[model samples]
Target chain A: MKKLLDIIVRIFRFIFFIFYYLKELVLSSLFIAYDIITPKDLMKPGIVEVPVDLKNDTAIIAFANLISMTPGSLSMDMNPEKTKIYIHAMYLHDKQEFVDKIKNELEKKIHQIFE
Target chain B: MIDWIAAFFLIAGSLFMLVAAIGVVKLSDVYMRMHAITKAASLGAILMLVAVSLLYVQWIVWIEALMVVVFVILTAPIASHMIAKAAHKTNMPKGPNYVMDELEGVDTDIPDKA
Candidate 1:
Protein backbone atom coordinates (compact mmCIF):
# COMPACT_ATOMS: atom_id res chain seq x y z
CA MET A 1 0.00 0.00 0.00
CA LYS A 2 2.79 2.42 0.84
CA LYS A 3 4.60 1.72 -2.43
CA LEU A 4 1.42 2.23 -4.39
CA LEU A 5 0.78 5.55 -2.66
CA ASP A 6 4.32 6.70 -3.39
CA ILE A 7 3.91 5.91 -7.08
CA ILE A 8 0.62 7.78 -7.16
CA VAL A 9 2.21 10.85 -5.58
CA ARG A 10 5.07 10.70 -8.04
CA ILE A 11 2.69 10.59 -10.95
CA PHE A 12 0.78 13.56 -9.62
CA ARG A 13 3.99 15.55 -9.21
CA PHE A 14 5.02 14.75 -12.78
CA ILE A 15 1.71 15.94 -14.09
CA PHE A 16 1.98 19.15 -12.11
CA PHE A 17 5.46 19.76 -13.41
CA ILE A 18 4.23 19.36 -16.97
CA PHE A 19 1.44 21.83 -16.38
CA TYR A 20 3.84 24.38 -14.94
CA TYR A 21 6.24 24.04 -17.86
CA LEU A 22 3.44 24.43 -20.37
CA LYS A 23 2.27 27.60 -18.67
CA GLU A 24 5.78 29.01 -18.71
CA LEU A 25 6.34 28.10 -22.36
CA VAL A 26 3.09 29.67 -23.52
CA LEU A 27 3.50 32.82 -21.47
CA SER A 28 7.11 33.40 -22.47
CA SER A 29 6.44 32.94 -26.17
CA LEU A 30 3.53 35.34 -26.08
CA PHE A 31 5.61 37.88 -24.18
CA ILE A 32 8.37 37.69 -26.76
CA ALA A 33 5.92 38.00 -29.64
CA TYR A 34 4.07 40.95 -28.16
CA ASP A 35 7.33 42.67 -27.33
CA ILE A 36 8.44 42.34 -30.94
CA ILE A 37 5.21 43.69 -32.40
CA THR A 38 4.16 46.43 -30.00
CA PRO A 39 4.89 49.91 -31.32
CA LYS A 40 3.86 51.82 -28.23
CA ASP A 41 6.39 52.05 -25.42
CA LEU A 42 4.23 50.61 -22.68
CA MET A 43 7.15 49.79 -20.42
CA LYS A 44 7.77 51.84 -17.25
CA PRO A 45 10.53 49.59 -16.10
CA GLY A 46 12.32 49.82 -12.73
CA ILE A 47 14.16 47.58 -10.37
CA VAL A 48 12.62 46.93 -6.97
CA GLU A 49 13.67 44.60 -4.20
CA VAL A 50 10.98 42.18 -3.16
CA PRO A 51 11.05 40.47 0.22
CA VAL A 52 10.67 36.77 -0.44
CA ASP A 53 8.28 34.80 1.71
CA LEU A 54 9.12 31.41 0.32
CA LYS A 55 11.90 29.27 1.81
CA ASN A 56 14.24 26.78 0.10
CA ASP A 57 16.62 27.37 -2.78
CA THR A 58 14.50 25.49 -5.27
CA ALA A 59 11.51 27.68 -4.53
CA ILE A 60 13.55 30.86 -4.74
CA ILE A 61 15.26 29.86 -7.97
CA ALA A 62 12.01 28.86 -9.57
CA PHE A 63 10.46 32.11 -8.44
CA ALA A 64 13.29 34.12 -9.92
CA ASN A 65 13.12 32.26 -13.21
CA LEU A 66 9.38 32.72 -13.41
CA ILE A 67 9.71 36.47 -12.94
CA SER A 68 12.41 36.67 -15.56
CA MET A 69 10.28 34.73 -18.03
CA THR A 70 7.27 36.96 -17.49
CA PRO A 71 6.53 39.93 -19.69
CA GLY A 72 7.92 43.36 -18.80
CA SER A 73 10.15 42.26 -15.94
CA LEU A 74 13.40 40.53 -15.07
CA SER A 75 14.86 39.27 -11.80
CA MET A 76 18.25 40.88 -11.29
CA ASP A 77 19.25 39.87 -7.79
CA MET A 78 18.17 37.76 -4.85
CA ASN A 79 19.21 38.71 -1.31
CA PRO A 80 18.90 35.40 0.49
CA GLU A 81 19.63 36.76 3.95
CA LYS A 82 16.96 39.38 3.52
CA THR A 83 14.88 36.97 1.47
CA LYS A 84 14.48 39.74 -1.06
CA ILE A 85 14.32 39.58 -4.83
CA TYR A 86 15.48 42.49 -6.94
CA ILE A 87 13.39 42.74 -10.05
CA HIS A 88 13.76 45.01 -13.04
CA ALA A 89 10.29 45.62 -14.44
CA MET A 90 9.35 47.27 -17.69
CA TYR A 91 5.92 48.43 -16.53
CA LEU A 92 6.06 49.84 -13.05
CA HIS A 93 3.06 52.17 -12.90
CA ASP A 94 3.16 52.17 -9.10
CA LYS A 95 5.71 50.79 -6.66
CA GLN A 96 3.33 49.22 -4.16
CA GLU A 97 1.28 47.79 -6.97
CA PHE A 98 4.38 46.19 -8.41
CA VAL A 99 5.25 44.64 -5.05
CA ASP A 100 1.73 43.32 -4.72
CA LYS A 101 1.91 41.87 -8.19
CA ILE A 102 5.06 39.93 -7.39
CA LYS A 103 3.92 38.80 -3.96
CA ASN A 104 0.36 37.89 -4.86
CA GLU A 105 0.78 36.68 -8.40
CA LEU A 106 4.18 35.22 -9.19
CA GLU A 107 5.25 34.38 -5.66
CA LYS A 108 1.97 32.66 -4.96
CA LYS A 109 2.43 30.48 -8.00
CA ILE A 110 5.98 29.68 -6.95
CA HIS A 111 4.85 28.70 -3.46
CA GLN A 112 2.33 26.33 -4.93
CA ILE A 113 4.95 24.77 -7.14
CA PHE A 114 7.87 24.64 -4.75
CA GLU A 115 6.22 24.31 -1.37
CA MET B 1 4.32 59.29 -40.03
CA ILE B 2 6.89 56.59 -39.38
CA ASP B 3 9.32 59.20 -38.08
CA TRP B 4 6.74 60.36 -35.57
CA ILE B 5 6.22 56.87 -34.17
CA ALA B 6 9.93 56.25 -34.02
CA ALA B 7 10.49 59.53 -32.23
CA PHE B 8 7.74 58.70 -29.78
CA PHE B 9 9.26 55.36 -28.91
CA LEU B 10 12.67 56.94 -28.57
CA ILE B 11 11.39 59.60 -26.21
CA ALA B 12 9.38 57.17 -24.15
CA GLY B 13 12.31 54.80 -23.87
CA SER B 14 14.62 57.63 -22.84
CA LEU B 15 12.13 58.82 -20.26
CA PHE B 16 11.93 55.35 -18.76
CA MET B 17 15.69 55.22 -18.64
CA LEU B 18 15.76 58.52 -16.79
CA VAL B 19 13.19 57.24 -14.32
CA ALA B 20 15.26 54.13 -13.74
CA ALA B 21 18.30 56.26 -12.95
CA ILE B 22 16.25 58.32 -10.57
CA GLY B 23 14.99 55.17 -8.90
CA VAL B 24 18.53 53.98 -8.38
CA VAL B 25 19.43 57.26 -6.76
CA LYS B 26 16.25 57.61 -4.69
CA LEU B 27 15.77 54.11 -3.32
CA SER B 28 17.15 53.57 0.19
CA ASP B 29 18.70 50.11 0.02
CA VAL B 30 20.84 47.92 -2.22
CA TYR B 31 17.93 45.72 -3.16
CA MET B 32 15.85 48.79 -3.92
CA ARG B 33 18.60 50.21 -6.07
CA MET B 34 18.87 46.94 -7.96
CA HIS B 35 15.16 47.02 -8.57
CA ALA B 36 15.25 50.56 -9.93
CA ILE B 37 18.10 49.82 -12.29
CA THR B 38 16.92 46.49 -13.69
CA LYS B 39 13.28 47.18 -14.51
CA ALA B 40 13.55 50.73 -15.80
CA ALA B 41 16.79 50.19 -17.65
CA SER B 42 15.64 46.98 -19.34
CA LEU B 43 12.42 48.59 -20.50
CA GLY B 44 14.24 51.67 -21.68
CA ALA B 45 16.63 49.54 -23.67
CA ILE B 46 13.78 47.55 -25.14
CA LEU B 47 11.96 50.72 -26.13
CA MET B 48 15.07 52.10 -27.76
CA LEU B 49 15.58 48.84 -29.56
CA VAL B 50 12.05 48.87 -30.85
CA ALA B 51 12.43 52.42 -32.09
CA VAL B 52 15.65 51.57 -33.82
CA SER B 53 14.16 48.44 -35.35
CA LEU B 54 11.22 50.43 -36.65
CA LEU B 55 13.51 53.04 -38.14
CA TYR B 56 15.83 50.53 -39.78
CA VAL B 57 13.47 47.60 -40.31
CA GLN B 58 16.49 45.48 -41.07
CA TRP B 59 16.59 41.79 -40.26
CA ILE B 60 19.92 42.17 -38.49
CA VAL B 61 18.72 44.94 -36.21
CA TRP B 62 15.63 42.96 -35.31
CA ILE B 63 17.73 39.93 -34.49
CA GLU B 64 20.05 41.97 -32.31
CA ALA B 65 17.14 43.50 -30.45
CA LEU B 66 15.66 40.08 -29.85
CA MET B 67 18.98 38.88 -28.53
CA VAL B 68 19.15 41.75 -26.09
CA VAL B 69 15.69 40.95 -24.81
CA VAL B 70 16.50 37.28 -24.43
CA PHE B 71 19.81 37.88 -22.71
CA VAL B 72 18.35 40.39 -20.31
CA ILE B 73 15.46 38.10 -19.48
CA LEU B 74 17.72 35.16 -18.72
CA THR B 75 20.58 36.84 -16.91
CA ALA B 76 18.84 39.52 -14.87
CA PRO B 77 17.33 37.13 -12.36
CA ILE B 78 20.46 35.06 -12.03
CA ALA B 79 22.46 38.17 -11.29
CA SER B 80 19.95 39.30 -8.68
CA HIS B 81 20.01 35.91 -6.99
CA MET B 82 23.77 35.88 -6.80
CA ILE B 83 23.93 39.37 -5.36
CA ALA B 84 21.22 38.63 -2.83
CA LYS B 85 22.87 35.41 -1.70
CA ALA B 86 26.21 37.15 -1.35
CA ALA B 87 24.69 40.01 0.57
CA HIS B 88 22.92 37.60 2.86
CA LYS B 89 26.10 35.63 3.49
CA THR B 90 27.93 38.87 4.27
CA ASN B 91 25.13 39.96 6.59
CA MET B 92 24.27 43.23 4.94
CA PRO B 93 22.19 45.66 6.96
CA LYS B 94 18.56 46.07 6.16
CA GLY B 95 16.49 49.22 6.31
CA PRO B 96 15.07 50.05 9.73
CA ASN B 97 11.66 50.33 8.19
CA TYR B 98 11.75 46.64 7.32
CA VAL B 99 9.17 44.90 9.44
CA MET B 100 9.76 41.16 9.21
CA ASP B 101 12.70 39.10 8.08
CA GLU B 102 11.88 35.58 6.93
CA LEU B 103 15.50 34.67 6.33
CA GLU B 104 16.48 35.34 9.91
CA GLY B 105 18.36 32.38 11.45
CA VAL B 106 18.72 30.79 8.04
CA ASP B 107 22.28 29.53 7.44
CA THR B 108 23.21 31.80 4.58
CA ASP B 109 26.92 31.67 5.20
CA ILE B 110 29.17 29.57 3.04
CA PRO B 111 31.22 26.84 4.72
CA ASP B 112 34.96 27.31 4.68
CA LYS B 113 36.95 24.81 2.60
CA ALA B 114 39.52 24.44 5.33
Candidate 2:
Protein backbone atom coordinates (compact mmCIF):
# COMPACT_ATOMS: atom_id res chain seq x y z
CA MET A 1 0.00 0.00 0.00
CA LYS A 2 2.84 2.38 0.77
CA LYS A 3 4.50 1.45 -2.53
CA LEU A 4 1.26 2.14 -4.33
CA LEU A 5 0.99 5.54 -2.72
CA ASP A 6 4.56 6.33 -3.68
CA ILE A 7 3.88 5.34 -7.25
CA ILE A 8 0.76 7.49 -7.37
CA VAL A 9 2.64 10.50 -6.03
CA ARG A 10 5.43 10.01 -8.54
CA ILE A 11 2.95 9.84 -11.40
CA PHE A 12 1.29 13.04 -10.26
CA ARG A 13 4.61 14.81 -9.98
CA PHE A 14 5.62 13.63 -13.45
CA ILE A 15 2.39 14.97 -14.97
CA PHE A 16 2.87 18.29 -13.23
CA PHE A 17 6.42 18.50 -14.49
CA ILE A 18 5.32 17.86 -18.05
CA PHE A 19 2.88 20.75 -17.88
CA TYR A 20 5.45 22.96 -16.21
CA TYR A 21 8.06 22.14 -18.82
CA LEU A 22 5.66 22.89 -21.66
CA LYS A 23 4.74 26.21 -20.16
CA GLU A 24 8.41 27.07 -19.83
CA LEU A 25 9.16 26.02 -23.39
CA VAL A 26 6.55 28.30 -24.87
CA LEU A 27 7.30 31.20 -22.57
CA SER A 28 11.03 31.08 -23.25
CA SER A 29 10.53 30.88 -26.98
CA LEU A 30 8.30 33.95 -26.97
CA PHE A 31 10.80 35.92 -24.93
CA ILE A 32 13.62 35.00 -27.30
CA ALA A 33 11.45 35.85 -30.26
CA TYR A 34 10.82 39.28 -28.87
CA ASP A 35 14.52 39.82 -28.32
CA ILE A 36 15.31 38.73 -31.84
CA ILE A 37 12.65 40.95 -33.38
CA THR A 38 14.04 44.12 -31.88
CA PRO A 39 17.21 46.02 -32.82
CA LYS A 40 18.78 46.15 -29.41
CA ASP A 41 21.91 44.57 -27.98
CA LEU A 42 20.01 43.43 -24.93
CA MET A 43 22.17 40.46 -24.00
CA LYS A 44 24.41 40.13 -20.96
CA PRO A 45 26.03 36.78 -21.44
CA GLY A 46 27.94 35.20 -18.57
CA ILE A 47 29.03 31.84 -17.27
CA VAL A 48 28.12 30.63 -13.80
CA GLU A 49 28.82 27.50 -11.85
CA VAL A 50 25.80 25.63 -10.46
CA PRO A 51 26.27 22.80 -8.02
CA VAL A 52 24.04 19.74 -8.37
CA ASP A 53 23.01 17.02 -5.93
CA LEU A 54 21.82 14.50 -8.51
CA LYS A 55 22.91 10.98 -7.63
CA ASN A 56 23.02 9.49 -11.12
CA ASP A 57 24.06 10.33 -14.64
CA THR A 58 20.63 10.26 -16.23
CA ALA A 59 19.16 12.84 -13.87
CA ILE A 60 22.19 15.10 -14.28
CA ILE A 61 21.92 14.99 -18.06
CA ALA A 62 18.18 15.70 -17.91
CA PHE A 63 18.78 18.67 -15.66
CA ALA A 64 21.37 20.05 -18.04
CA ASN A 65 19.16 19.54 -21.05
CA LEU A 66 16.21 21.21 -19.34
CA ILE A 67 18.37 24.20 -18.48
CA SER A 68 19.53 24.47 -22.04
CA MET A 69 15.95 24.51 -23.25
CA THR A 70 14.84 27.09 -20.73
CA PRO A 71 15.06 30.85 -21.16
CA GLY A 72 18.46 32.29 -21.88
CA SER A 73 20.45 29.54 -20.17
CA LEU A 74 22.67 26.89 -21.71
CA SER A 75 24.63 24.07 -20.17
CA MET A 76 28.15 24.54 -21.45
CA ASP A 77 30.07 21.85 -19.62
CA MET A 78 30.42 19.82 -16.47
CA ASN A 79 33.39 19.28 -14.19
CA PRO A 80 35.31 16.04 -14.08
CA GLU A 81 33.90 15.23 -10.68
CA LYS A 82 30.34 15.96 -11.93
CA THR A 83 29.63 18.02 -8.85
CA LYS A 84 29.38 21.32 -10.72
CA ILE A 85 27.97 22.42 -14.08
CA TYR A 86 28.99 25.45 -16.09
CA ILE A 87 26.17 27.43 -17.66
CA HIS A 88 26.21 30.28 -20.16
CA ALA A 89 23.28 32.58 -19.65
CA MET A 90 22.18 35.27 -22.05
CA TYR A 91 20.97 37.68 -19.43
CA LEU A 92 22.54 37.39 -15.99
CA HIS A 93 21.82 40.31 -13.70
CA ASP A 94 22.23 38.65 -10.31
CA LYS A 95 24.44 35.62 -9.82
CA GLN A 96 23.46 34.36 -6.41
CA GLU A 97 19.78 34.91 -7.07
CA PHE A 98 19.96 32.93 -10.26
CA VAL A 99 21.65 30.03 -8.51
CA ASP A 100 19.08 30.07 -5.75
CA LYS A 101 16.19 30.14 -8.21
CA ILE A 102 17.45 27.10 -10.08
CA LYS A 103 18.14 25.18 -6.90
CA ASN A 104 14.82 25.94 -5.34
CA GLU A 105 12.62 25.57 -8.42
CA LEU A 106 14.15 23.36 -11.09
CA GLU A 107 16.53 21.24 -9.06
CA LYS A 108 14.04 20.61 -6.30
CA LYS A 109 11.39 19.52 -8.77
CA ILE A 110 13.83 17.19 -10.53
CA HIS A 111 14.89 15.71 -7.19
CA GLN A 112 11.29 15.08 -6.22
CA ILE A 113 10.72 13.19 -9.41
CA PHE A 114 13.97 11.28 -9.81
CA GLU A 115 15.41 10.99 -6.33
CA MET B 1 -12.41 25.87 -36.66
CA ILE B 2 -9.85 23.19 -35.96
CA ASP B 3 -8.37 23.76 -39.39
CA TRP B 4 -7.97 27.43 -38.61
CA ILE B 5 -6.27 26.62 -35.33
CA ALA B 6 -3.89 24.28 -37.09
CA ALA B 7 -3.13 26.92 -39.66
CA PHE B 8 -2.43 29.44 -36.96
CA PHE B 9 0.07 27.12 -35.31
CA LEU B 10 1.73 26.42 -38.63
CA ILE B 11 2.12 30.10 -39.37
CA ALA B 12 3.36 30.83 -35.92
CA GLY B 13 5.89 28.04 -36.15
CA SER B 14 7.18 29.33 -39.47
CA LEU B 15 7.47 32.82 -38.04
CA PHE B 16 9.47 31.53 -35.11
CA MET B 17 11.81 29.73 -37.49
CA LEU B 18 12.31 32.95 -39.39
CA VAL B 19 13.07 34.76 -36.19
CA ALA B 20 15.66 32.12 -35.36
CA ALA B 21 17.31 32.68 -38.71
CA ILE B 22 17.41 36.41 -38.20
CA GLY B 23 18.84 35.91 -34.75
CA VAL B 24 21.62 33.72 -36.06
CA VAL B 25 22.69 36.55 -38.31
CA LYS B 26 22.11 39.42 -35.88
CA LEU B 27 23.46 38.02 -32.61
CA SER B 28 26.92 39.01 -31.51
CA ASP B 29 28.74 35.69 -31.24
CA VAL B 30 28.43 31.92 -31.33
CA TYR B 31 27.01 31.61 -27.85
CA MET B 32 24.27 34.10 -28.54
CA ARG B 33 23.56 32.50 -31.88
CA MET B 34 23.13 29.16 -30.14
CA HIS B 35 20.60 30.71 -27.80
CA ALA B 36 18.53 31.43 -30.86
CA ILE B 37 19.00 28.06 -32.48
CA THR B 38 18.50 25.70 -29.55
CA LYS B 39 15.52 27.44 -28.04
CA ALA B 40 13.62 29.21 -30.79
CA ALA B 41 14.30 26.81 -33.60
CA SER B 42 13.49 23.68 -31.63
CA LEU B 43 10.30 25.17 -30.26
CA GLY B 44 9.33 26.22 -33.74
CA ALA B 45 9.90 22.71 -35.01
CA ILE B 46 7.88 21.26 -32.19
CA LEU B 47 5.06 23.65 -32.91
CA MET B 48 5.12 22.61 -36.52
CA LEU B 49 4.97 18.97 -35.48
CA VAL B 50 2.06 19.69 -33.22
CA ALA B 51 0.29 21.44 -36.00
CA VAL B 52 0.86 18.51 -38.29
CA SER B 53 -0.47 16.04 -35.78
CA LEU B 54 -3.47 18.21 -35.15
CA LEU B 55 -4.28 18.29 -38.84
CA TYR B 56 -3.99 14.53 -39.35
CA VAL B 57 -5.60 13.29 -36.14
CA GLN B 58 -4.39 9.72 -36.44
CA TRP B 59 -2.96 7.67 -33.62
CA ILE B 60 0.08 6.66 -35.67
CA VAL B 61 0.74 10.22 -36.68
CA TRP B 62 0.36 11.37 -33.10
CA ILE B 63 2.86 8.76 -31.96
CA GLU B 64 5.31 9.77 -34.67
CA ALA B 65 5.01 13.43 -33.77
CA LEU B 66 5.59 12.66 -30.12
CA MET B 67 8.65 10.62 -31.05
CA VAL B 68 10.05 13.49 -33.07
CA VAL B 69 9.52 15.92 -30.21
CA VAL B 70 11.19 13.58 -27.73
CA PHE B 71 14.15 13.05 -30.01
CA VAL B 72 14.57 16.75 -30.65
CA ILE B 73 14.27 17.76 -27.01
CA LEU B 74 16.80 15.07 -26.10
CA THR B 75 19.40 15.76 -28.77
CA ALA B 76 19.34 19.54 -29.31
CA PRO B 77 20.79 20.34 -25.89
CA ILE B 78 23.61 17.79 -26.19
CA ALA B 79 24.52 19.12 -29.63
CA SER B 80 24.56 22.72 -28.43
CA HIS B 81 26.61 21.72 -25.37
CA MET B 82 29.18 20.06 -27.60
CA ILE B 83 29.61 23.19 -29.66
CA ALA B 84 29.78 25.43 -26.63
CA LYS B 85 32.31 23.17 -24.94
CA ALA B 86 34.46 22.96 -28.04
CA ALA B 87 34.41 26.71 -28.48
CA HIS B 88 35.42 27.25 -24.88
CA LYS B 89 38.17 24.65 -25.03
CA THR B 90 39.56 26.14 -28.25
CA ASN B 91 39.46 29.74 -26.97
CA MET B 92 36.89 30.96 -29.41
CA PRO B 93 36.37 34.68 -29.59
CA LYS B 94 33.75 36.05 -27.22
CA GLY B 95 31.38 38.87 -27.93
CA PRO B 96 32.10 42.39 -26.82
CA ASN B 97 29.41 42.39 -24.15
CA TYR B 98 30.24 39.41 -21.95
CA VAL B 99 30.46 40.21 -18.23
CA MET B 100 31.87 37.16 -16.41
CA ASP B 101 33.29 33.71 -17.01
CA GLU B 102 33.24 31.30 -14.09
CA LEU B 103 34.46 28.37 -16.16
CA GLU B 104 37.89 29.88 -16.57
CA GLY B 105 40.61 27.58 -15.22
CA VAL B 106 37.98 25.00 -14.32
CA ASP B 107 39.17 22.57 -16.96
CA THR B 108 42.78 21.58 -17.28
CA ASP B 109 42.60 20.32 -20.83
CA ILE B 110 41.77 23.65 -22.43
CA PRO B 111 44.84 24.74 -24.37
CA ASP B 112 46.48 27.75 -22.82
CA LYS B 113 46.08 30.36 -25.51
CA ALA B 114 46.07 33.46 -23.37
Shift of residue A40 alpha carbon in model 2, Å:
1.7
DockQ per model, Cα? 0.09, 0.66
- Best by the DockQ measure: 2
Worst 10 residues of 2 chain B by lDDT: B104-113
The Cα local distance difference test for each model comes to 0.65, 0.88
lDDT tens digits, residue span A1-115, model 1:
9999877876786588656644654454445334434455454445566789887787777777777656555565544364666665555677888789779987876676567
Error of 2 at A77 (Å): 0.4
lDDT of 1: 0.65
lDDT of 2 by residue, A1-115 (tens): 9999999999999899888877887888898999999787767889999998998787898799789878889899987778888999888999998899888988888888888
Question: Interface RMSD of every candidate?
Answer: 8.5, 1.7
Candidate 2, residue A47: the lDDT equals: 93
True contacts kept of each: 0.14, 0.80
Candidate 2 DockQ, CA atoms: 0.66
